[model samples]
Target: MWNPKATVENALILLLLTLSVMAKTVFSQNCQNTGCPGLKECCSSWGSCGIKDDQCGFWCFSGPCNLTNKSYGFNYNVSAGPRGPIESIVTPSLFKRIMSKVGNNCPAKGFYTHHAFISAVKSFQAYKRTVAKREVAAILTHFAHGSEGFCYKEDKARGKYCSPSKKYPCEPGKQYYGRGPLQSIRWNEYYGAASIFLRLPLLKDPDRVAQSPEVAFKLALWFWTTNVRPALYLGFGESSKRVDGRLCDNLHPNDTKNLVNQYVNLCKILEITPDEDARSEISAFWRRHLSALMKRCASTRASIITGRYGLSFVR
Candidate 1:
């Protein structure tokens, strides 16, 4: 009566069946309009239904949808970026103005130039389906605050931020302090990786990040495109966590719920409205007031009731 072997076999069959269901695949084009099988599933570039990174990876539908995972920003070639027309909502002039206002006295010169920064941003924007104006503003605001409103590299070198690994080695007599617009903390790994991706020898000469404005901007863009943007799409709280790499409560120890206050403050400086909660609240308030007013009028009909005796008021 106790056939444990048969029961074990049945359990194994069910497990295999569940695995098959979870690993479903589809073409990205097909899922574009219809969407994936599961609500949380995103269609991979290879046309597979998957969750998290699998669905939002580099191969996902490259369009103006803003659905691609921005958790880490993606990079694309000047010509072969996303699939659609790359329209920069933040005009070149506006971008320059913002940079000048927020950046330090450093000139956007040498290898670190404005042209390079603009080109890099254009390429970065191509990866996203829809680039919100507020998002663009937020990027500038964050950089401005991070660098104290300047294209600055930290003056006091704390020490070499070299990793001393076989993959990326520190040059003898060279130090990698915080460099670039966003001030990358440990330059060896982060800058080294970005250098490899960008086909530059930044790891060999880490100082280039500080010397060149374009390079500095590129480093900032790389961070934003990869780590910052994706988290921001989730929400301010998620973005902060991504930036801080810890619990929201830890970041704002005094008031965990107020963790996104810095982001909110930056938004205010940019004059970008906060998320739609305020608008929704205003709408609800008006509806309630209108309903109450109508009810009061209905209950006191005598106040303005239609009467045969001329326009005699009754209360």
Candidate 2:
């Protein structure tokens, strides 16, 4: 009876606002399923849809035109897989050596000694082989480069350490001097590489390197595929040679040897022949691991597409 045009415009505006709010609510829920596809739940799980925060436990990325595309959660499946046989073969000897360094109580602190490190590597291999469906060599390559900084503090504090370089000083006040099977550190090299590859803010908060091992590993893998591997290929003709140089030059000769031993342990765990040469052995190991990892990622993506679009599940 009054102004029909004005009323229609107001109603449209309200409808748009309501739709926005509803969409926001739907994307903010937590991802309950561990098996959920790539980042479907990571962005929303942090309590605000598409809101990126360092402490949110996920990395969000938007598409061209600023449309939200996806978020990535920390990968923890690396810790899963077959361990018994690998542990039985490598644990006793590796543990004896590690205990001599970090002490017998190291495992209680979530700080894996050398033997524990080997066990983890083997477990990771198994995970890649079975669940991730990625190449073992690629996985091993990721692991080797990613595991760099775990022992830096322990080595330095005990007077048995050498610096990666005087130009890049180690900050003792920082608890995450890079420890673990992966030599992950808070250095610019790692952080920068991770930022670019994972599209995450790894460099902004250095503490995540220590506080979250799974996150650290994800960063490591990202760096390896995007930067480290290419650099290694350029530096040395053979991938194994590059890995050996990284272990010996970037870290320590002993650390390199220890990692090799871990590789042997992993092979034992996987029931595969442990290649004699340090470079070849790890190269083969990672090749197998990467194969599985790629498969896992593909599977995860497929599930997400199916679920989001209401398509029939493929796997």
Model 2, poorest ten-residue lDDT window?
60-69
Model 1 spans > 4 angstroms off: 1-88, 100-114, 125-130, 155-157, 244-272, 276-315
Q: Give Cα distance to truth, residue 203, candidate 2, Å.
A: 1.6
Model 1: per-residue Cα lDDT over 164-205, one tens digit each: 567666677777666666653344666666777667788788
Candidate 2 residue-wise lDDT, 1-315, digit = tens: 789999999999999999999886554432211111122212222233332342122222110111111221122122233333433434456445433444334332344344434433443333333332112433453354443323321212112112243433334443323433444332344444455555655545555544554554555444344323432212111222222212211323344344445545545545554432334455444333332222222345435533453321111
TM-score of 2: 0.34
Q: Which stretches of candidate 2 lie over 4 Å from their true place?
A: 1-108, 111-181, 184-186, 227-257, 275-315
lDDT of each: 0.47, 0.36
Would you give me the overall lDDT of model 1? Answer: 0.47
